[model samples]
Target: MRNAWSRAMVRGAWLLASILGSSAGFCEQMNLREFGQPDGLGNLALNALQQDAQGFLWAGTENGLYRHDGQRIERVATQELRRVAALASGGGHLWILSDTGTWWWHDGRLERVLPRTAKLPQDVPMAIAARGDEAWFVTVGGLQHVVVDRQTDSWSSSPVMTAEQLARHPEMGRLASVMLARDGALWAGCGDAICRWHRGELKRWDARSGVARQQWHALLEASDGSVWARSTQATLQLSAGAEGFVDRTAPSDRGDPMHRYPLVEDAAHRILTASQLGVLRWQGQQWQSFGKRQGLPGDGRVHALLSDREGGLWLGLRGTGLLQWRGYGRWESWTDADGLPSSVVWTMQRDGEGRGALHVGTGRGLAAFDAAQGVFRQVPLPHAGDLFGLVPDGQGGLWAATDVATFHHVRDGRGLPGPITTPGGTEDGFLWALASKDGALWVITAGKLHRWPEAGRGPVQAVPGPPGNAQEHFYDACETPDGTLWLAGARGLARRRAGQWLSSLAVEDGVTYVACGEDGTVVAASEAGQAWRVRTPGAAKPSLESLDAPVLKGRMIVSLLIDSRGWLWLGTDAGLVVHDGTHWKLLDRSQGLAWNDTSGHALYEDGDRSMWIGTSRGLSRLIDPSQVFATALPRPVLMSATR
Candidate 1:
């Protein structure tokens, strides 16, 4: 309650008193601080670094790569002074590779290319491994073999191969990069692929061609010959079944804006980082990037987020607030301080002409905001109401749905008004979910579904179902990509597609809830722990599964949200389950999703990609697809116990 200096004075007095007095002899002082970038690394962003076999630590910096030998700092430059794509260790030297294949470095002198006829592509150079006199370097451009003739102190090229070259090599793609495994098996990230070279034999692995995996990034061969490969997007293990790149933190992530920090996958060291941008391996040397790539939110737990046709971000959050990621790692956030009603916004919908309207859902009522009105004005409705959902009908007249017993707020002469007393069926339970598909308003009632066709429909026709299995009531309803109108019920599942009541799934599948995504992925949760995901048949799926998250094996997942990355965010009773579908990781009291949900409750993804979990302990959030916590948890209001 005091000013900064006053607070400082109080702290100083406490410290002085603790040091001078306290018969208990415990002299302790608390120091609070706002987190910022690492100070020693200074202002320049660090990307990555590698420790060579010797005692030197090579650091990747924004301006240039630096080599430190405990005493002197050596500045590394590209062969042509271009942007250094990355630096790797090979043949007892810190090899500096640029985005361009034109390899160059300073062997205790000015930086210069080692020996390459062309420039590499723009992807950062990942790994460089040396075996005997033969050295291998991987770049976005392609893979190259550099032979260091120690006898002559010179370098020679074996062959320059690109992904396309290897693809056309009459075999698989060229090796992206090569590394010596702990078991002596040579693994190669060939082309957009992976392969093993053993006993003068090259065994190529490509998940796409039924080989193994394509987006191969790095390969790790355990001491027992078990192979682990990290894909371009997910992670995969050989003996454990191949998968994509993975997130193995407290909660695995997929680049959400709600998180304050990001969860970047570090494939090089096989660690998940919470830095700024998502880099691969980090042996404590890399840039400070904050987003889903590392371990935080990409934007903020965006209560509402609008993406422009140009892919720019417009966010709205309750706590840490809003932001817009321009590109790469550049983002901008808007706040009430910057002209807005409040940050507790809810749903956002894209209107005509590529414009987005953000519906700010506060404790009071609903409001709207866009580029035109930087601030929000309460939607003029009949009475005070709490907004539940907002759907933009592509036409000028948008539909705002609320949950105050009376739903529907139509736009009249004023901005938004009127709770159109649409007949909510002759039931008593609340309308838990809403959806509009195939030109019809699909509303889920307590035990049945009501469809109001816009073609002169008065009362919504209630589709009758087998008596309310009182024990089981519908929670949510959806029209799947397969044109099946499905309902998430308690005892069993129900569906009505074409004038036929198809409740066969009830007898077939043991499901309690159903969540179908536009991505043809149908996930249903059972009363038991197993969440059956009936994925549409696809090719090369098993090979792309990542067994990376070592945590989410047995969590009884309840609610499922198919996020922007196409991964599923499973809110469980005991914890939060994150999986690209195949491989899963758990997030609980230890990993952040600390809700006392021994019995699961409501789960939602706010307008922003932030996942909101409503449990017994109130609400928790997962900003970074990996982190689940209560960022904007409501503080309890306690009246005086007595006079």
Candidate 2:
């Protein structure tokens, strides 16, 4: 039954891609799959990937090393060897280099390669190249080589290139990529040039030889003894020249070179390069690109690429996690199944029939998040480029604000036929804010404010609020309990009462967000992370009271919300700041947040008071604010002692 359901979904995705004019058979020809924490990957921030001789793929991540067979992934249990950066396999063993040190796996047992007392120039090894019993290690100090001594159950390393020899090369102490040539010589790519270390000497060619002196990202030696070198701008072929290995442009590389890792030549001799734009290949004399449209996960750059022996291509994307594409147009993407649609989430809200359901505004569109299922059901909005904010429409539905215009979705899962455009609104100005108060709908454009009296009962009219000269600088606005609307502008906060415009508070740094506390206290957040309490007067002018908090002094506040507990939740560029009338506390990525950079107007609290945080990376649902600062239960005070 599951197989049948998956087949049906695949068909639907293929049909949708076809209608969108994507690559022919994009969904049918390729299947993309991603793997991450849910699949037992130690971390999402991947650094390197290597397929061992045993057909198992090894991944180096920030947390530790993970090994994946054809079926499952398992974390390699090493003694204090976490935070791996690179991996290599050779001589029936796996070489691992991490911040901790270097280790090699042999015969189902892992052993430290470096002696405990050996003094190395640099502690961290950046790149490794291995073949047979010899492996090359590149570090900030210089290039070194190690020879495995199986008979002695030990390994020995020596300097392959002296610092003096490397001084002439580009990015001398920063050798990033290395590979072995067919002639038993070592080739390495540095920041400035590609060098060959042969016969105890170093040789290099630069822009003078038609190959520009840029960072050489990767190097690969083909079966036919042709070496392929990749730089940010070009890919070159180094064949056997009369004097030595001469460099020439690859006939297949016609576009800008992907600044990714090394080029891989598959079993079919097809040269491929994984890049931010997706995977590219040189086939039939031309380069072909495959991206998200071609069904290769999110459009993040592919950090790690592997050409499996079974005719499959594996990719480790920075944001999208692991993706696999088997031959015959099959691809699959693996990620946090319960995470946001895109890491760059813009806004989020809680909606439901009394029970909270997550609604996320993302770069793609609107998504309905299922907390129990840990999945997001995407609901694409027509013509909505980037959703910015979502607000409850008093009737359980929501008002969605986008880059183009404001859209209204009615209760009972129905949407209006067209956008709710404000009359006399600037066509060039993007929609910034949307709110409904006292049976009136208010929309803020680049420079002007539009209001629909009686919540669309009357024709839209341009309401005077922002200054005529700088209409585009308004950031946010909200309504107080007394039907008074507050606007945050470049100057500061302004209030409108009974159709009369009044400047309430002005600050030099500008105000970005405005929220009304339950006790009728109007809190205005400044772009520089300062908050001011406004005293809403009945008939007199409003007064401003600065609410000083050292914790939020320098941060840029993106959104401000007053929860039921009367705590002012300020979403800022640094993190989340909570002001409980007097004291201020911070919650950030270190405190269980998926991302620290919060988006403007992206904070929402459900009836249950679970805070929903929208950030530049993804959406975070915090069940209890107190849990952020988890404290160990008070140890039973057996006896009170005075020190």
Which stretches of model 1 miss by more than 4 angstroms? 1-346, 353-355, 360-362, 373-377, 383-385, 392-397, 410-414, 422-429, 455-457, 467-472, 507-512, 526-529, 535-559, 563-566, 571-577, 585-643
lDDT of 1 by residue, 356-382 (tens): 343443324455542332334466665
> What lDDT score goes with residue 409 in model 1?
42
Q: Rate the local accuracy (lDDT) of all candidates.
A: 0.42, 0.62
Residue 598 displacement (Å), model 1: 16
Q: Assess candidate 1 and give its lDDT.
A: 0.42
lDDT of 2 at 74: 80
Q: Compute each candidate's TM-score over C-alphas.
A: 0.39, 0.46
Candidate 2 has what TM-score? 0.46
C-alpha RMSD by candidate, in order? 21.7, 20.1
